[model samples]
Target: MTLWPGLAADAAAQACPAGWPQWDAFARRHVQADGRVVDFSVPEQQSTSESQSYGMFFALAANDRARFAAIWRWSRDNLGAGSDKLPAWQWGRREGGSFGVIDPNAASDADLWFAYALLEAARLWQMPDYLKAGMALLGQVKAQEVRVMGDLGPMLLPGPVGFEAGRERWRLNPSYLPLPLLRRFAAVDPSGPWTAMVQGAARLATQSAPQGFAPDWVIYDAGKGFQPDSERSVLGSYDAIRVYLWAGVTNDGDPLVAAVRNALAPMTRAVVSYAAPPEKINTVTGAPEGRGPIGFSAALLPWLKATGAADALAAQEALVREKWQTWSRAAHPAGAAGDGEFNYYNSVLSLFGWGWLQGQYRFDAAGQVTPAWACAA
Candidate 1:
């Protein structure tokens, strides 16, 4: 019942002849000349904190330090708005660079993610200015909108709309989004507001998922606590595991890691039993979602490596190999899938997986040194 067969053997080819070339083509197609990566080639002129963060990391992975630096600079200069301004909005128009959309305003989880991205960029580049900008944005988050959940502790709310009212909506996604920012902040400025917010969000998320499985979504009301609903997303849980792993390794006595470990056990079991080729079981339920291709399989590798579950990592590697082989055989010589706009976004995920498998990571499950290929040299 898996999506593709023989994928594992194909992924084990070690290196694909056209892999890097295909990846480079994908990056060139999506990344605009101005250094900003558009989100999914949408016509409305929108960019994303997640895309920017991944884009920067991939650029660094490819040894394009200048592009990485340029993206970070453009993000800060245009996305940050002004002095003492909050982090960038989730979505905005390229024309005037405003951040007032219903889906991507400043106060949403994406803003915090942008701050986290800057923190990572600063760490990689060792530039004090990026760290300063990250800290400034974190300070704004704490000063303007973080709230306390009775037992859950401090959490961030969505920021203001057009200089007036705040969104005040609490989301589950930010719980994972802010951890990297906190980890980086803790390394430099241990006593800063970002550190506190990180702890608060972890506590709240853990408490909310007492059953060890978080609901797909939740809405946080100012007066009331977290209200659970059925709008669940497998991607959200997958991202949450990454955040918890980061916290567990970076900070001492992290309960979030324990919760995630327990929650993911069933999903891992399902994959072991039934996952064929490129398919992954739903983290919440044991059912197969579909064939994950390269991107999703790649994203899961970090978590698998972080957990030190060798079997899981092996399974994922097999799936990735299948995807690469399939793409290689079917696609034309240019690496384009014949789709103009939807070029290689999915390939970014594959590159990330390949990079990690080749030992490009900040921390491992055992806290050993695993540097990127370029960094290792």
Candidate 2:
């Protein structure tokens, strides 16, 4: 599917600076001579395949064909290897120009994320090799994994760490990670295992916050609903909202849309009222829980855009604009040069929000898109 032309143009414009050459230079700097991303500026202080996957997709969005090709090559040479065949490592620091895995434990979500990223990249770049790699990764997960509590269905955690075997309850991120898996599965086999997984995740998410807003973290035992802990202002919630919005647009008649709509209400208010630099309030009425970087707000834009509620959308837009203005006035660098760890993720979100507001993507009168944001954009 072709991106909405207007949105594509807008995204391309927003991805770069006023001078195209400078933006191209920035893109080049992140990509190493070997084509892997080496920028410390990216979020999480790790060289995640997930981030590279996103970088590839966004590179396409920005119309950086060369960068896209480079990213594809890098991902293939590095991240495409399986666990048994050199198992992907998390980012780690090392001396003498070498890197190591931060933790031996493999995160299931990371693998799934890479798979989804590869699939999307394949579609965007029209490279069958990427698709083949994604399918192979999925096969690996299916061949060796078990049902994790919060994961909806059976999931494969990374190998050699053994964290996946002993855990009775799983941690909650629940938004970005699963959505891509579901989307990828749906694309390949509509009647496949992905639909069930997506529905299960939606159900689990709703159960976690029966009142609508989920906790920052939750524990889930297989066949049991979510066990809530303290709620925090998590960037994951916004990511979940984006996934829900995609589901809503894809299946408007689905009941989960309304459920998601209801859940996001309080989150919207919380960000608008109490969020501060590097932190978001946990409870709508309570003290600030902890520091949340820009990533928290980045997820908010897609949620607002999907909701299409004029008042809420306006509020979200204004809040983000205000935050950007604040950051700019404080002399923070634009596009992932902020003073925090999750800066790149947040920068992407903020840019996406700005692009949406500037009419990068097509939206209805209420500001909701008729299709998936990626598809529409």
Residues 216-236, model 1: lDDT tens digits: 345555556555533444433
Q: Give candidate 2 regions above 4 Å deviation.
A: 1-29, 39-45, 79-89, 95-97, 145-168, 176-181, 190-192, 229-255, 275-292, 309-312, 315-342, 351-377
lDDT of 1: 0.51
Which candidate's lDDT is highest?
Answer: 1
Clashes of each: 5, 5
Give residue 371's error in model 2 in angstroms.
Answer: 12
Tens digit per residue, CA lDDT, model 2, 1-377: 35443343533223312223222433544555555655456344455655566565455545566776676676556554443532354553544546655444444555565566566667766788878877787666555533544446643333424433234755554543334346556557565566666666666556665444544445566556465544333333434444433432332334455665565465555555554322533322334456455445444555555555446555555666676656545433333453343255565544344444443333332222322234434
Error of 2 at 346 (Å): 2.0
Residue pairs clashing in model 1 are 7-322, 11-321, 107-158, 107-159, 216-232
- As for candidate 2, its clashing pairs are 7-360, 83-87, 106-158, 278-292, 279-292
What's the distance in Å from true for residue 152, model 1?
1.6
RMSD of 1: 7.7
- In candidate 1, residue 26 scores what lDDT? 53
